[model samples]
Target chain A: MSERLNVSKTYKLYIGGAFPRSESGRSYTVNDAKGGFLANASRASRKDVRDAVVAARKAQPGWAARTPYNRGQILYRVAEMLQGRCGQFTDELRATGLSKSAATTEVEAAIDRWVWYAGWADKLAQVTGTANPVSGPFFNFSTPEPTGVVGIVAPDSPLLGLVSVLAPAIVTGNTTVLVASETAPLPAITLGEVLATSDLPGGVINILTGRRSELAPWLASHMDVNGLDLTGASGDLAVECEKAAAENLKRVLRPVEADQPTDWTAHPGITRMTTFLETKTVWHPVGV
Target chain B: MGDAVSVSTETLTGAAELRRFLHGLPGVDQVGAEERAARLATRSIKTSAKAYAIDLAISMVDLTTLEGADTPGKVRALCAKAAHPDPADASVPKVAAICVYSDLVAEAVRALEGTGVGVASVATAFPSGRAPLEAKLADTRRAVADGASEIDMVIDRGAFLSGDFQKVFEEIAAIKAECGEVHLKVILETGELVTYDNVRRASWLAMLAGADFIKTSTGKVSPAATLPVTLVMLEAVRDFRARTGRQVGVKPAGGIRTTKDAIKYLVLVNETAGPDWLSPEWFRLGASSVLNDLLMQRRKLTTGVYAGPDYFTLD
Candidate 1:
């Protein structure tokens, strides 16, 4: 398998290392902020959403089974790759309409946030969890785990919000199917390139670009999905998202109204490990 | 690097000329009506804020945060939440109406059926309000027909700044007619209006044209609502009450997040509108998080423990 080499085209969706077009056979262009066209992104359908879920389910056991130390190392490596490609992301952001200085700062913050999460992959369990001291002999400890497959509606305003939402989900363990902001989806799709190079197991993160009203419901109501984050949607769409998540008791994050600025410090650490955690209670026999 | 940068003598003069030309633009002297000042008084009328309560009619507008999921089930759940207040102290002011987008008005009205909460829809293009008047009117009519008790329309700040107050007034008056017995809240998008004087003038124009409540912003733009602008608006409301004796409400929406901010608004209302305007009828917070924080603080006061963000359900 290692010896054989072949040329490959890269304009395909990467899920579980198997590149495929959207099952819908549909593609749409992601435009720069100046209204110029960039590369085309596959408009994911309900079928692609299912395929991504399958890939994530397959990858979950092994990834979650890895020791925290190894997971942290891998995540750190991702931060390294992200740092190496900072200039590339900066250019994409600038092309997406952010001022040069804004783009640079955003790229740097995105990279730094990743590094922060990288350090967090191992430590989140301790910080966000607890060991209950009950009156029984059973030792019960609560550890945060991935919530399985996550569906994130990325903020319409790109850069900070995009990375802010995505990083928390994947760093813990729940794989994500993000509907990138329609107006600024290019930078998000480009992030997939960095994930691919960084040795992140495929399917841990899948980026889809399309109309929010079109694709979001499919992801929200999917039986396999465990959680939903509706940060970008406003007004009625937000209400629709809340209603959709209630179907399976999926954990929901409400939309942040326009007036409230994103408080970077109050960002949740819970996403890192809600899915994969099983909450086991162990007991030991004692002699008198 | 070899060539030294040089500025021509005429370039400096040209820059100065451009600045003077901009300052001399027509309608620059027009100050917007004091929407914030009027609202501050409304807060006082219900809360016993001091004096000036008789001149202002305080109307509370709510930006409902009940987001629905794609599933109609989720929609129903949100409907239930919207219909029921997240249980807490009933003593805090009762909102005048549950304000929402057109699509959710039906749900909001349905949820609020048995409750005293009337429904208000933020129509007429909303936040941006850049669409055609026909479109805006149609949106307003649809919301009203759909059971909205009030309409919050945004004045075309672009048109207003370009000295088209006639268009702005006509639009408000037209929407007011469509409203019939329903109320009207005209948003001036104060941040874009740019100055205290323009803000005061805009307030006067909206009230004179029949705005029941003059709101601050659409919550779409940054720096949307601020305290200083509110102060100027209160002064205008005081002046307007002195002139017309018609009590108008004020709504400063967008950026307000915490109890401290809410308290500051309450204080401003007491001082500006006096004690009479301080009630749920006159004062409201256009917020999603404020209710939660209020509930959390209320819980602490009652139970002596702080609740987690996830501790309470929307309903």
Candidate 2:
């Protein structure tokens, strides 16, 4: 007889620190690059997105209240978890059809990028805010704050692109409801497992794996989602999401023109961070 | 067996009459009651029936806001919501009543003055019936004087569970007398009462003492008004009417937050208690946030698409 069968894992959605099946009890097949079957990922429904938003909204206040230094530590812990799971990451990426070297390089950069963002958590406010000279008898200043819950459309590069969008939004204390790469959701769910073990609290980053068309429109029109990132949306779908997002005047980050994704490993700078931060300017009587 | 005296305890007075009647009552099977409630919950009601149930459930709501931090402003806003549940949709019926604490009864009464919706006040130590008889009676009288047309009194779970069934009966009778023309809704606080048997017994105990309606919980306690508990109480009221010609209402307060949950309660009432108990006169849901969900669902039924919370009133 063959050796004991491995306990297979069922890919589930990550919402508010728990791995739950899609409320609709739906799943779609995910195949490796060679079209070999891998596993099924939950085909998240709009109700799942609504639940994620509720959870993100619930966790955001406490997360935003944590000291920026503490948030930095949590993000760094995520990088640490990613590094420990480095072998697994490379393996998952390899099965997605990337060459071994490309897979290894992507895993390394993803970890490095997370570490890079971990440092930005505490520094973002000082880098983005300014003291203003005004004509009134008051001290005036402007500072960027977390803009509450953001809905992210993850780029198709799987591990690197998923990390590229998720790390920045959460580092700033804004909770996120993110859709993982549709075709390449394995690495994304694997990342979700890493996130569960990391010190980062649940709902700070919720990952739902489902169709971009079916899920993105709900996120776009969702009045609760304060911002939308359309990095992963392509062609007419991008245009449709932008149109829907206008209902609430959501702060939208559309893809670079002509259906191109940004270079994932390139210096992402504060663009990702600034995209989700709301600027609050304060003025108080100087002498009072 | 002398005063347990058949099922006609509605007219039965005295401690012996009430206790013998309560003890002689059949014991509730927890598994059976819960299973029946769960089974009824699985009934698939849709389209026109769903729309009707949503609207009917809205009409049966006692829009309640009972809190330590409740203020006149909150009570007034609740009253406004009770009168016009949807400011945008006039087709939506007004709630049956605006429920508040005794202190806010006057505010609720004044805000709902000409709206035709009654004011129901939770009195007699409310969530806990721990106050002395004088204070409890004063609480009831004050709410009634402040213009509360319905007095929701707690049945002293501590007294009821202590086997002092007679004391519990007299307290309700005393409160009922104080209620006068005002409807008296006795809250069993069944969560603390512990068992289905106790809930069934307490239901009969309150009815024997002239409770106009028997409510499940005070909306403060955990396990407040579960579907099974409400089903048991609905059955009690249904049986009570069959034994005596008089009718009493049943209110499953707290934790019923969705239109689906409310409709399930309606189904239980319709099938078990019969269609006679379908109207607001015979049934009610004591809830606060339930109105908003009902309105959202009502809008979903009106418009083909789902309604967002932003489109509704914050009250």
Give all candidates' CA lDDT scores: 0.67, 0.89
**Docking verdict class for candidate 2:** acceptable
> Residue A13 in candidate 2 has what lDDT?
95
- Displacement of the residue A147 alpha carbon in candidate 1, Å: 14
Instruction: State the lDDT of candidate 2 residue by residue for A1-288, as single tens digits.
Output: 889988878999999999999999999999998999989999999989988988898899999999999999998999999999999999999989999999999999999999999999889889999999999898889999998889999989989889999998889989999999999998888898999999888889999999999999888877777889999888888888888778767788885662865788888878889988988999989886
Query: Individual DockQ of the candidates?
Result: 0.02, 0.24
Point to the candidate with the largest TM-score: 2
Q: What TM-scores does chain A show, candidate by candidate in order?
A: 0.85, 0.97
Q: Model 1, stretches more than 4 Å misplaced?
A: A1-288, B1-61, B65-79, B88-94
Query: Where in model 2 is the C-alpha error above 4 Å?
Result: A3-6, B1-7, B43-49, B258-260, B299-315
lDDT of 1 by residue, A118-163 (tens): 7777887787677777786656676666767778888865766777
lDDT of 1 by residue, B1-315 (tens): 011113221232342332332233233222333454444434422323311221111223364443333333443454444434344534443445666777777876776677676777889987788999999989999999989887889899998898766677778889999998888888889999877667877887787678887888877777867776766666566656665677777778888765446666666766777655566555555654555555544443454322333555553
What docking grade applies to model 1?
Answer: incorrect
Q: How far is candidate 1 from the true structure (C-alpha RMSD, Å)?
A: 22.4
Q: Give Cα distance to truth, residue A286, candidate 1, Å.
A: 39
